[model samples]
Target: MKLRKLITVAMACIMVFSLAACGSENTQEDAAATETTTEENKAEEVEETAEALSGTVVITGSTSVEKILTDMIDEFTALNPDVTIEYTGNGSSAGIKDTKAGINNIGASSREVKDEEKEDTLAEEVFAYDGIAAIVNPANEVQDITMQQLSDIYTGKITNWSEIGGADAEIFIVSREESSGTRSAFEELTGVAEAGGLTSSAAVSEGNGPVQAAVAGNENAIGYVSFSFIDDTVKALKVDGVEPTAELAKAGEYKLSRPFLFVYYEDKATDAGLAFLEFALSEEGQICVEDHDAITVD
Candidate 1:
């Protein structure tokens, strides 16, 4: 009887130990499951935060660059509804100055930053190439002109449209205002040297539209503007029989064409700016430009 009782006690102890082992294993499995759940919740939160990018960025300057920003606003807002853009066309010089003062997130410039500019707060990106075309009233009937002829007209060297194969009318030269990048480009090509160097004889206007308007409204008037600015209201004079199309400009066949620039403060660049620039340089941005009758870098 004693032996039998002893054996029974041993078996009972073994069963209790086995039960304890199983309980411990179940607890370990439950703890592992809880840990995995906690990790998954944290991952979901990070994903949510990354998707929520929002802010306002402002850009101002060259009216020539306004179209690109117009295109960007539509597409960028569509992709990121939380972001907003505000822009203005105060001319390229105004834009550059505003960026330096930190009043604007970006500045638009057709001419590169000149060495004489007081501040060095700009970082630049090449956006597109612009062909500055010499325009005259459609009724003027001027067919062709060389670079020399253009310079002569602006310097009062050649006053009559007839000298360049047009009607027998005095050339009404409409020029760009001092702050205009178009003026800078015109001066560079015509050897006026700087903004104020235009001869006293040529008439001056404030913006591209005014230049076009001045020329279009007056049969004897002539001025220059970007190829994109040419419309039915004015005529685009041929330079050496080569038209100012984007393809011709890209090949450097158009003599007066120059690169356009998008400028910003280096310190003002945010994550949004980096992403937006990348998008603009990508296939999508190029496609937007092509659709809007503007040139792309490809």
Candidate 2:
């Protein structure tokens, strides 16, 4: 009877050990399976978030800023394939108007914001700086100019290039539209605004491209444009002996410089719009700005 009891107890102990071992193995397998599932879930969440970031962002404003902004858009869209950006090369004033009316995601301007436009929730971000180059026909002999001379020329006081030691031909003045940011900044900086604005005889172009074209096509025409827009087609004259360049603009030596701006309504901003602005201020975006001949904000 004693032997029988001892054998029964040993068998029970073995059964319990076996059951415990099986339970331990099952628990480890379950933990591994749970960890794998959790990892998969995390990956799926990340993918979903990426897929959710899709939309169209509309940007309009300064024709002067078109080149740099287009380059930035190209790079940004490459990174975010789902995000679409549409840019229109309206003048800066029109851009500001669109932003104020919530008609565009952002407005581009190459000039300082006016005090009157500062009302309400209008916000601005300075993305870059640019010097306004005073361009002339390459055939003209005048190599440099002064601020007073420019002001006088635009105000119709100086009508002949010979007045400033150039060719004996009459000076053909090219001016931007009254609503142009470039025109505003140029007039304000060169004292033309104080002199009652551009003369009536000046040919008013709607954009920088037209201005450059006008100057390039005429041997006696003079106009102002963003420094980035200067090409071999036109000759950029020095203002007060200071050359219009990104380096000089950053150092404050170029008096014709202005800030490149992004104007938007804070409350009405969209996710993609904000993201695009953030990217424009990023290092990569600044590189694009510099690459396109604009001075970086940094």
Alpha-carbon TM-score of each model against the true structure = 0.78, 0.85
Off by over 4 Å in 1: 1-50, 118-121, 194-196
Kindly report which residue stretches of model 2 are placed more than 4 angstroms away from their true locations once superposed. Answer: 1-49
RMSD of each: 8.0, 5.9
Report residue 246 deviation for candidate 1 (angstroms): 1.0
Give me the displacement of residue 124 in model 2, in angstroms. 0.7
* Model 2 lowest lDDT segment of ten: 45-54
Clash totals for all models, in order?
Answer: 0, 0
Candidate 2 structure quality by residue, lDDT tens digits, 7-29: 99999999999999999999999
User: Candidates' lDDT values, in order?
Assistant: 0.77, 0.91
Model 1 over residues 72-127: C-alpha lDDT tens digits?
A: 77787787777777888887889888888777887778777777764565678876
What's the residue-level lDDT of 285 in candidate 2? 96
